[model samples]
Target: MIERVLAIRHDKIGDFVLYWPALFLLKSALPKASIEVFVAPAVQALAEACPYVDHVIVDTGDDKATSQKFIERNYDAVIVSCSEFRIYKMIRHLDSAYKLAPKHNWYQHLYKHTADAQYKQGEACWRGGCMLVEHFLTQHGIDIPELPQQYWDLSAERQKWRSYYGQEGNEKLIFIHAGTGGSSGSLSPSDFANLSTNISDKTQVDCKFVLTYSGAEEELAQQIFDQLSKKSIKVVMAKPLSSLADFAKSIVAADMFIAGSTGPLHLAGLHNIPTVGFYAGRRSAPIVRWQTLSHSDRRLSYTPPIGKRTGKNMSLIDFNAVEKDVVAYLDANYA
Candidate 1:
């Protein structure tokens, strides 16, 4: 009988967030099951806030930590969403009834049972995650079902975040993440400045842009704020967010979010926030791969023409086209 479960996905931001449906399935299959998430320390807060998760264990891939994670507790089942070889090796601790993981190599034999994630070259990431989760549940005699765009319950936090930011008025608030986090193309501050003004011109509703960035993005934010200053658009540099939780709160409080395919974009998707994401045209990193997993109608993904898949090649993403879509999306949804 499955009573306690461990779900592991010690990966990056978007990668970790993509496990929404799989996690949902785990809880659904075993509502009374004590579900714990094993994630990188980077996403501890986010995992903690997950309503389906009962506990959050920060898995740092060290030998000692792995032993402690495995030996310290008794799990009835184990699920691995991360493809790290070492992570698979640490499955020695799972003396459970079921161990569900994606079969990639000989190392996968470590798990008593496994599923094929069937990763295609340009597959939608969230779907692949769902497939693995579904494979596990079905193989274990559970049926798969539909899932929400995400599973975040931040009602209390939403109110608190709004009050903290102060409810100024009905002015639409669009959170813009201007800096690259080593994951996406670097849209220059000037490009964003232009986008802000273009959005203002395109949207019927009066909107304000809140520029949010990580610790390393301060200088980039400054440049964006300075550029926005050149225009009449009402723009504010968001107060420095201290953690991933704080960042999520800010997204909850915003009316819309704009960014490249980065962490906050996925965070915004988790809350079903309307988002316009800029993506590259590379086959490996196509729009379908990391498209924001928000409400289908609420998400807009824009990609450049297919060409060189290098960083410098990001400039090929037609900024003008993106601006047009942003305007149209807002007008269609909010207008």
Candidate 2:
């Protein structure tokens, strides 16, 4: 039995969140195994919060030291998920009984010739229909169990949400996320203004618009809030969420989620919240990969080509296409 494991995935918030299912499966398969994770420092808190993880080692620029530390621990196996040259090199030097990672022909030279196992990440596509997380775990001989979707749960966050927007029985909450990091996933200020106006003009319900985004998008969030305020839309911006659980709770409380293809969209799916995804440049890859829950519907503005160069060559989709989908979703689900 695998008594100790090291799972390495050093990526963004959404990347880490998507691995929840795999983490669950690993824990179930080896209940007694001490699972340690090597992750970006920003996401170290998330790894520590996971009940399955026994320890978390942050990748703070000292690859040799990190590998040495793992060697000393005498881990049974190491699972590498990062697609970085530096990370692959470090994993190759680690002394583990078994090693598993996504197979890439280009990087074969970086791994030990006798590496115990190598799993291809794309195996999910051929498995008919399974969540990417499940696909990853199954490759490692782990079975996924039925678990309530994972979310970051923060005690004070709920209270803060309640206090900021007085919890009235009649209030209808609609969450809007307007910005993405350095991409067209950000709605033009005018598009956001138009959307907020349209919602108020068409709906008679006691509607409120909630703004959510990382601190990096503060300026854009403010712009959207100001536009909605002019339309007399009740707007609330909670402090940036402290954990994935807090973000999930905020999405769960909403009647519907309207956002670009970003972290909130995925979180909405996890919570089974109905969402209108306003994808910017092209079709989102994750939406196509995972089977949507019964409550979810995806409206892509631009259907990207079916190849590796797809998203790179696409131009911005017409805003009218986005407006139609959002309006249709709101009318059907909310009205």
Q: Model 2, range 39-102, lDDT digits (tens) per residue?
A: 8887776677666678889988998898788788788777765556777777776677666655
| Pairs in clash, predicted candidate 1 | none
Task: Give per-residue CA lDDT, model 1, range 1-335, as digits (tens).
Answer: 77788888888877888787678877877798898888889999888877778988887658677757765778877777776667766766556767777878777876767787876775667777777778877877887877865567566577666656554666677888886653455677777788889889878877888888777787888988888787777888888778887677567887788886478888888888888877766656756677776877887776666666542465666777877887877777667
Model 2 residue 258 lDDT? 71
Q: Model 2: residues >4 Å from true position, as ranges?
A: 109-165, 182-184, 241-250, 283-295, 298-335
Worst 10 residues of 2 by lDDT: 122-131
CA lDDT, every prediction? 0.76, 0.61
- Compute each candidate's TM-score over C-alphas: 0.91, 0.74
For residue 64, what is the lDDT in candidate 1?
73
Clashing residue pairs in candidate 2 are 151-245, 152-244, 152-245, 152-246, 153-245
